[model samples]
Target: MDKLKINIAGLELKNPVMTASGTFGYGKEFSDFMDLSKIGGIFVKGTTLHERQGNPYPRMAETPSGMLNAVGLQNKGVDYFVSNIYPEIKDLDTNVIVNVSGSTIEDYAECAERLVGLDKIPAIELNISCPNVKEGGMAFGTCANSAANVVKAVRKVYPKTLIVKLSPNVTDITQIAKAVEGEGADCLSLINTLLGMAIDINKRKPILSTVTGGLSGACVKPVALRMVWQTYNAVNIPIIGMGGISCWEDAIEFILAGSSAIQIGTYNFIDPAISVKVAEGIKEYLDKHNISHVKDLIGQLSV
Candidate 1:
């Protein structure tokens, strides 16, 4: 993993491959398939100030090359994590990052502040761009001012690596990236599922109970790559690229575009070992291309 070492903002990753929040659950679930320590990082499921019931049934639907989810940030709350989950995962070898979400500015800040006491948990990924919830999910992400406000509030409490994940639903993603950057975000993660809807033709109604859900998987790669590239040029901070990355080549395309790291999301459903395979595949790519380090590939794309 020598050549695979990457420093996204201040977090040192063994490699640039990690499981996206929600898709991977806690690091414990995948232990049967792969070593948790081998993962670059684990972005745990979304945690709120209190336990959430999440969205209603029919929250998931399959599409042509992707999947839509209206999971609605379902979790057992931040307190539950600090009390129960933290003790279990604290010993894992990889970086444990909390994906923090809330309904108000205070909710996000308070949740982050609580994790502050956990030494094992080094950072928090602010889920300001979650598209599934109605109250505070995508609301804080669509506008620059709202996005900036969320970051600013959380920045006050979260002392460690502060990564603000962005949404692709905006008219201009780079603007949102720049706004968060101005608010002192250490790193940025792009293109959290795009907002889309599916229909149940048989019933002539929306497939998702919520009418619309966040679209992810292979279908979103192109849009995600474009946004990562645009945001990379727009801001000076590090970027973690996600969306439609099911293979090593897809991961390389993102590094070439400007991603310092990449997250494996929906693809985990297809192959639980996909993250490990992709990690090894990246090393093989470096050896073949004679590239000394993975960081060399970041923003290496030439016009």
Candidate 2:
């Protein structure tokens, strides 16, 4: 059998596969379709200090090979998660990472302070790629200074693994990646969702109520892979690369390009068992290639 285990900032994952935030609600939702214990980790929906209703109707729009969403970080507060969700899955066979979002630095810090003591939650992923809010979110992630500030502030309180989730709307992703890496981020997740819009030519109006949304799925793979490769060169910490990853081939590209692990996003919307399929595919490849460990493929690129 192949060695699938890998450590990302001290968190031991059974494999290098995980679900992106916002795509997978709490792990309990998909318990019926697939066994949560079969995968590496679960980065659940973005949680804030309080409950969020998210954006108005039509929060989702389909593109050629991808989809756009303005689902404004709708989630129950972190306290609710600790009280209701944690006790059930704390002993599951996978890592439980909470994806957090906030409207201000203070909000983010406060949330982190609360989660720092909860040993059940092994890690926290800061969701800095949301664009629908009036303040914070993707706005903070686009700039190098602000992006680092949030990570630094959270790092002060969150003693465990801190994964900074980056936005894909930036001009140069390496600048932001280097900034966060310097500020004590334990790991990173890239290419959240590309900024895009859809117009209804007939009514001469936009499709989403918010007028714009974050695009995710197969169409954005190339753009995401480029960003991941660039960031991998820039940062010293591990990267949880994602964006348009739907199959084993996609995951392999990310690993070879320097991603320590890959996150499955939009694929879950279509196939709930996509993560499992991807894990199986990775194993098959390892066996055929005579590889003893998945980590051997990390950054094994041709010159």
Question: Which stretch of 10 consecutive residues in model 2 shows the poorest summed lDDT?
Answer: 129-138
- Model 1 scores worst on lDDT over the 10 consecutive residues at 129-138
Question: Model 2 off-target regions past 4 Å?
Answer: 130-138
lDDT for each candidate structure: 0.91, 0.87
Question: Which model scores highest in TM-score?
Answer: 1
Mark the regions of model 1 whose C-alpha exceeds 4 Å error after superposition: 130-138
Best model number under lDDT: 1
Task: Please state the error at residue 189 of candidate 2 in Å.
Answer: 0.6
Question: Residue by residue across 1-303, what tens digits does model 1's lDDT show?
Answer: 799998887899999999899999988899999888777999999999999999999899999899999988898999999999999999999998999988888888899899998999888999887432445345788889888988999898888999999989889999999999999999999879998999988999999999998999999999999999999999999999999999999999999999999999999998998999999999999999899999999999999
- After best superposition, candidate 1 residue 216: deviation in angstroms? 0.3
